[model samples]
Target: MNSRLPATPETLAEQAADWIVRLSADDPGERQQAEAGYRAWKQADPRHAAAAAHLESLLGRLDDIRSRGTQGPARQAIHSARPRRPPPRLATALALAAALLLPGWIALQSAPADILFADLQTGSGEWIARTLADGSQLSLNSNSAVDLEFDAKTRTVDLLRGEILVDVARDSSRPFVVSTAHGNIRALGTRFLVSRQDDATVLSMIESRVEVRIDGQEQAVVVEAGQSLRFGPGSENSLAAIDGEMLETAWQQHQLVVRDRPLAAVLDQLARHRPGLIRYDRSAIAKLHVSAVLPLNDTDRSLQLLANNFPELRIRTLTPYLVIVDHEKNR
Candidate 1:
């Protein structure tokens, strides 16, 4: 049976950071509301309260460090020993800046190095389509990257990260293949979509068929048109039916057509189009369902539509690079 567990420690720490950011807002009304919301969140679970306290203690230590660094003896000793130290107020400002920006900074830095050097790469919120020398069409999703290797024997696409839609040109002599960390998807016919996730590679066959071969596996699984499969190194998911039109809309029309899917799934797609970090409490929004045809190119408008549709959800764009989504109950 499926069951939900308490929020993980990592999630709790993120929530604590969210509270700190919210409570530090400049507007008095916003700060007051954030404080009330934080109190309720802290009271919801002992873990939540402890996490908040621990973060507060860390901030306190930063203040202590700033004080000590600027004191008479330390300041004089440092000045005598070397060049002048930064002003106390400047040091305090820098400390505050680091505390405010560290979470987003860490998240930004977490992107894979392979993406930077990929033969073809798209930035956040950018999408590109290209026709290869073989006359095959390829489209990359936002924040996606791939390295292409074309030779006399084979046409290969190394999907370093994110998703790609390929319309393969018929080449009897050469086979078209998409490779991920877990497996290789060899196109049997015309079109297909391959997405690389943390754990598995998702194959959505659009026009024809594809053969998925997991690493170290002898046999290959055939996915026909209108079918989807998720496979990793060790296991293969049962083939499931997919909406071909929906997959086409994603690449051709640049829109997300959702039907009774989890809110987290929608947010995952939005995160690709959005720059910076999209942070949320998974446990809070896990049960919420979303059904909408949202524009992929305009994520801000899509987010606004979501907010209008779900009053229970509070979506805040904390910074250009940081978005926070949380449930009203948590507040």
Candidate 2:
């Protein structure tokens, strides 16, 4: 059996980093193995390709740094002596931010350096669908993960990161519950979507009903179809009625249907499907609103559509991994 386990994005990124170091070696055998391993990994997951592409871009920048020939004595010593050394965190961070296209991301601080665990995750521009053993279905958006445990008493899935769409199968003996670091969502024979934001979790119901319980809370707030709730670590709960049909189910079809959503918000959503950063002059265009059906499958095309709609909007690409949007005069 292939002992190679399913690669999470973090592990894959590390492997990509290692391969970057190894591929630079002059030894033919090592270079061949590194190349082979990289090809296999890239074939294993679409996300791996994004990781590899990013490493390649970073390597180009390193070459640029070397070509500049402007190194201090200390830096030169480190570079000449440590030929096989891994790239610095700053370089990796820069490359990763570019690869993820973080809009207006300044540096490593904006990178998700702390997130370490994800049982299942998608790449920057990938989506996946899985059928659980119990016949329930789950689909993960790009850059998302979930830890699942199914047993006699419960079928629990911890949304370690990102967003998930769950279609729960009815099993009276085992209650299906989905959780994030912020709170838990008990699915009551429902089809629903759960997204983990920086400081809050957003839950939207598509069918049937579900109960929301914040961590360490007793009273469960029931959310039915056509309803959405945003909760944080504390007991602060904000619930609203929404048309889940357009916003919730549209992603399954690779579409985002929004009504008068701000440009920043739309870019944020679009960033999930792309690798690297999609940065804009937020201060200048934060209030610019858009209403359209943006395609999730081809994000670059979607960006083009957005630009075409707004004559004042200008899109600039520093590298394939870095995109900037701003007014033409600000270019």
Candidate 3:
């Protein structure tokens, strides 16, 4: 059953599948370990490479079928099993994947400029609120970074990484603009939230309106109050109406509002405010829905809240920075 004894194509494919699932883990340490283990297993035998290649080809075929925009049993099953949420548009689906995908974290860690060029930055499990020279209030989430560039003509804020809530001051002469890897958000005397994801920028208009321009696009998309949009390379998704709860800006209040969301998604959001990593069972937790207000300032309490509500869920801490959550099995 072990990888060392693998000789058949079927066994190699199973091992490859395990590696693929592990590589999708949200924890950085787990992902690195999984990748290292995968490499070692692949090198153990030449046939392993061929079997892995075959599995990859099969996945590619599945992707191609998906790209054609055809609906089948696989698509229906995927959609039905997922938690209730907004429909994922092309690039939008992969944009926020940094929370669940290993490659996204890898890309973020490799970006030296995100730190080297940042004018203001906050470490993991830290929060900061500051007022700019123009009197605009800015609140950064954990592990967030931004660069301020204000001049006579324009007020530009380059979001290096993470999320920020901006309460913009009226400046007709100097338009307040926030830029990210995917696009630019120009506030028109308003308050808004901007979060930089793995492959896109998520903009939420809280007050008045903001014009969004995807990178390399001349035309801008206007998002009014109670609306949010996600745009990425070569694709701009449509706007979705925000709920009255205003979940996007809840971070400013040090609270995470969950309205019947999957446990897996909740853990993903919680990982943002905490240091190190949070590992959990995606399939098992996805079946369980959560609806509660968790405190952002104290992640441990937030976790306790989850455990309290879901008695079957077990939360374990191997270290101060590493946590594993899973469902309790019947003996």
Candidate 4:
């Protein structure tokens, strides 16, 4: 018996899988109805991103069930699961500046560092990318920041918060390195992504191999093309295999793909990409799972799109600092 959830597989696929389950109802007519409404809502405005994200999340989880043949396991069982908490104030700040303030970015720009080939950051509803001096690429996840120091000795970056994807151009002398709150990630002629989750560090290897040494104890994770792992501060790591096509790397092409992730996890991603925070009463909807591929540029439109698709969900704008998600919308 899978004790993690209360719903049966059929129940999950039918009525109770999520805040967007109605989009997959018994009647084909009803399914198309929901989808049509969702499409129109997505087209209505730019900020409808939160809505699209939620729907995408639902569809992604459904696909996972189709492929993996099970409902969502506990988030903790997965190697990439993270705790749900208030958006870091820093992330919220970044969210506001990166999207709406891009025209102002040139004002903040300084001479590019020699070793630090590129530096990119985004605010809510914003995304940014940069070409490294070495012909590599660095894509900054929403609400992410990096202070880079790179040279022949090593490629070093400080992840103040959020996540960064580093695509390394092969170089033997200039080894690529990333430092996060948890530990240091060193690449052996590799490409990888590093993220900060609270005090822990999540590492995903997209190519070759990388080594994570914590407190001088070297551990070779040797992530393959689609493997992911999370090493908490002073703890062992949980390994998970990933499909790169569904990751934020896809965001480079104006896409956001998700997998069998919890509602809280999806909400955090929204918070990172948009101004303000999209929070839920976790006590009210903790068991739901989400997956999606909404555009990364507009979160408000996404939220509107989500509300239209899941008529059962009630979204209340409490204030600029917070938005609440109700499991069912008021009729």
Top-scoring candidate (lDDT): 1
Q: How are the candidates ranked when ordered by TM-score, highest leading?
A: 1, 2, 3, 4
lDDT of 3 by residue, 264-318 (tens): 8788778878866676657776689989989988899999999999999878653
Q: List the residue pairs that clash in candidate 1.
A: none
Kindly indicate the candidate among 1 and 2 with the higher lDDT.
1
Every model's TM-score: 0.69, 0.64, 0.60, 0.56
Model 2: weakest 10-residue lDDT segment is 65-74
lDDT of 1 by residue, 76-104 (tens): 33334446556543333333344445544
Which predicted model would earn the best TM-score? 1
Off by over 4 Å in 4: 1-120, 214-218, 233-236, 246-249, 304-312, 317-322, 328-331
Candidate 4: lDDT of 177? 74
C-alpha lDDT of candidate 4 relative to the true structure? 0.57
User: What's the candidate order when arranged by decreasing lDDT?
Assistant: 1, 2, 3, 4
Cand. 1 Cα-lDDT: 0.74
Worst 10 residues of 1 by lDDT: 69-78
For every candidate structure, what is the RMSD over all alpha carbons to the true structure, in angstroms? 10.6, 13.6, 15.4, 19.3
lDDT of each: 0.74, 0.71, 0.70, 0.57
